[model samples]
Target: MQQKQTPSALDRLKELLARAGFDWFLGALIGMILLAYLWPAPGVQEGPLSLGELANYGVSLIFFFYGLRLSPEKLQAGLSSWRLHLVVQFSTFLLFPLLALPWHALFKGGSNELLWLGTFYLAALPSTVSSSVVMVSIAGGNIPAAIFNASISSLIGIFVTPLWMGLFLSASTEGFDIWQVMGKLVLQVLLPVVLGIVLHRYWGAFAEKHRQKLRYFDQSIILLIVYTSFCESFARNMFRGYSIPDLLLLGLTMICLFFLVYGIIHLISRMLGFKREDRITALFCGSKKSLVHGTVMSKVLFPDANMVGIMLLPIMIYHALQLLAASVIAQSMARKAGVAAEGE
Candidate 1:
């Protein structure tokens, strides 16, 4: 028999990074943030390629492609799991806000009000579609349900997130217009999505074939938005008051928030007697927040564009942490499921 060779340290590191999702644009995200800090001038809206215009078009395209890929039959089939869907939506829109609201009360009259608002914004956002579906599928979850819940969550958030923000922003800020925000959302987001769904019958297969490349396209748009937002913020010195310790604390808080939701979903799924797959779907779909929606919505919601970077702080942190944590959990669950199946 031939002896098997041991993997080198480099191979081990690569495996670890892959498992944790670090290899999947996480490094690029961090690099984008740093680039924003260093040489952010070109990313500004005034520059060529016009970061703002490109991001606007990109957001529409991203959602259009999303709708194009979704199958109505899959959505209809997943609708049977009403209980699972309710739990996920409730956790996302209700529980997340409830959890974040207290943080505002706790930190009331503090210098971190902006940060608290950012947290609330994070909480109010919907669960991510692609990552949630990917994580659920990896963990052997009910993927159709994941897809349905994630997609619907985005749709619901288009109306709900602004309503939630309006309540607070109206009282605190000078110009918070609900109708203006809704108009933009309808034109840019809803219209494109509807168009894509209508066209899906013609191009669905083509979309599926090119989804890998499309995913990169989606990320590129996000990076552009991030770089632009942070550049504007840096130019205005919005990050001046923030320090390393503040960021570290925010990161820790995000991790705690993630686990709290994850644990709650797990408990609820068990109490409701969900099968393993449904349980996995609920836990993942409930715990996630969409950075895509957060970024897109911030452009409309916050009139003071400079503060957009501060608003996105919680979102960016939570996005990275959730991907890392969810990937690890999914891998572990997959391994155990495999072991059990083999034993059976």
Candidate 2:
């Protein structure tokens, strides 16, 4: 009898890449940065910033589709899990913000105000959708609750992130009207999301059918925003006096931030008597963030803040690193659980 062939290492690599939605996000980010560095353009005339306006609509539509796909019954049930919700939200809004305060204080010098804003922005963001759900499934978390938590978290972020920025940014940043920013968000993010939810019926099947292809749309929008934002930064010479060590420190800072948030949420989940599954959901969903919201909002929220581009520097790094780190962590957890089961 012929023996069955095992998959080779390349086959395994393909599987990981497909699952991760790996693309030129980093490559695009690098290219965009280089373009910005080469053809810096702060002098571009602003004509109501239609791109930002469009991005606003895109953000809204994203959330709208999420709201559409969300089952109301599931949301109600998830809401009833008050303890779970508390642990998740506390880790997101309160815990991250509190930690950012010290991080901000330590780095609150020179042009690092943008860095502080970025730190606060992370505190303000909501849980990610795809990754959180994936991690929940990998770790055997409550899958339905993960969906509800991640979806609701994004919806909550649109409002909360802007408000949080308003409070913190008002004291330090200049030339930006907080209220105007909020208005832009409501018009762009909120309204479009509502539109998408309403129209999801028409595009739902198509969106689902070509889901892999459409994932590129998501990255395209973010990459465009990154290019534009960095171009502005380059035009304004935001990276002047910055060194390689600064980037290293920023990476270290992000690693610390990620682990600290992850640990705090895990500890609180244990204390609250969460079951194994819910605890996994709590840890993953609570600590993660949305690059979608961050990029879109940065345009409106800190439009005049040229320094904000550098602020996003660490977050962009953290975003990629988190994906890689979380993937490894989830796999390790899965294997350990299996080992324990075998041992028992």
Candidate 3:
């Protein structure tokens, strides 16, 4: 009988590369920037092919992987902690929108219409699936609850996001058809995922074999989306509104939002008397803002809207920063707990 070889140091290195997630996204961003600089695409207003078609047929494959990974058991288990699920969902779809209102007012009638729109988009985004679950597991959080809430959040955002765009972005949101938006999400996002998940049992081995490559593929699609979107924004001069100082202010605002939500969730968990594990889950999962949903949904939901790149800015910034900051906090907490365990 043949035996599988143990992972050597070199094998471990490759596995780590394969497992490398969000940071590759940042690299993809750099690559797209280079592409833009080397060969600028003409705008629709100006011309065509200035930006490429971006993803050809690769996106379907990305969704397929998502479906393959969502185990039936995880779905069942995630439902057990209904309370935690509620907390995370409310934090995502509820809290962020209310907060963006003031920022919208503050920036109205400005050239930064795109920036303001991006903040609104940020508010309406769904919670993430992979990164949130990964963070929850790392932080010793409630996995089932994280999975349940994150999964449901995606399903719910299909309806809620368009309603938000129409209602809140009332000026240009005229003639927005909610049903059409629903169809786009179902076709592009939800249906693709469902198809992948359904075929998981048969294709599981194939997916595992190319997992790293799939991750790279996913990142590639996102960067293309970002680049094409940003290239459009630049071509339209949507960024003319803000200076470096505005970006500084935007970063500060994001910091405040993160801590405020973190504090509020911490307080609620205490009031509800959740155990440590559940509390950890609540803190990480509830605090996240989804980048994947924001990116994909922007293309579908705002098929005709202008300045989507600037509009998606808050969530994108928040997404990367949140990962870094949460990672630091999670690590610190882990170290502290380790010391306490030693003492005990």
Give the Cα lDDT of each candidate: 0.86, 0.73, 0.72
For residues 1-344, write the lDDT of model 2, one tens digit per residue.
99999977556444543465444576788887787788756323355665444554555555555545545566676776667877887787778878887666666765666666777887788877887888778767888888888877877777788788787678776766778887887786777666655666677666667666666667777777777778777777888877888778778888888898898888888888899888988988888877767777787788574765786786687777677667767766776888999999
Tell me the deviation in Å of residue 90 in model 3. Answer: 0.6
Cα lDDT of candidate 3 equals 0.72
TM-score (all chains, Cα) for each model: 0.93, 0.88, 0.86
* Candidate 3: stretches off by over 4 Å: 1-22, 34-38, 42-57
**Judged by lDDT relative to the true structure, which candidate is superior, 2 or 3?**
2
Candidate 2, residue 242: the lDDT equals 76
* Candidate with the greatest lDDT versus the true structure: 1
Using TM-score as the measure, the top candidate is 1
Please give the ranking of all candidate structures by lDDT, highest first, separated by commas: 1, 2, 3
lDDT of 3 by residue, 1-344 (tens): 99998877556433333332445576666566556444445322233333334442345556667777666777787787888878888888888788777777666777765666777787778877777777677667777888877777877887788788877545566655777777766787778888877887888668878877776777777776677777776666667758998888777778788888889889989999999889988888888877877776777776553466677678878886777767766655665677887999
Query: For candidate 1, lDDT tens digit of each residue in 60-146?
Result: 888899889877877898898999999999999999999898777777767788999999999999999877887888789999899
Clash pairs detected, candidate 3: 41-50, 42-50, 67-197, 118-311
Q: How many angstroms is residue 48 displaced in model 1 relative to the true structure, after the best TM-score fit? A: 9.1
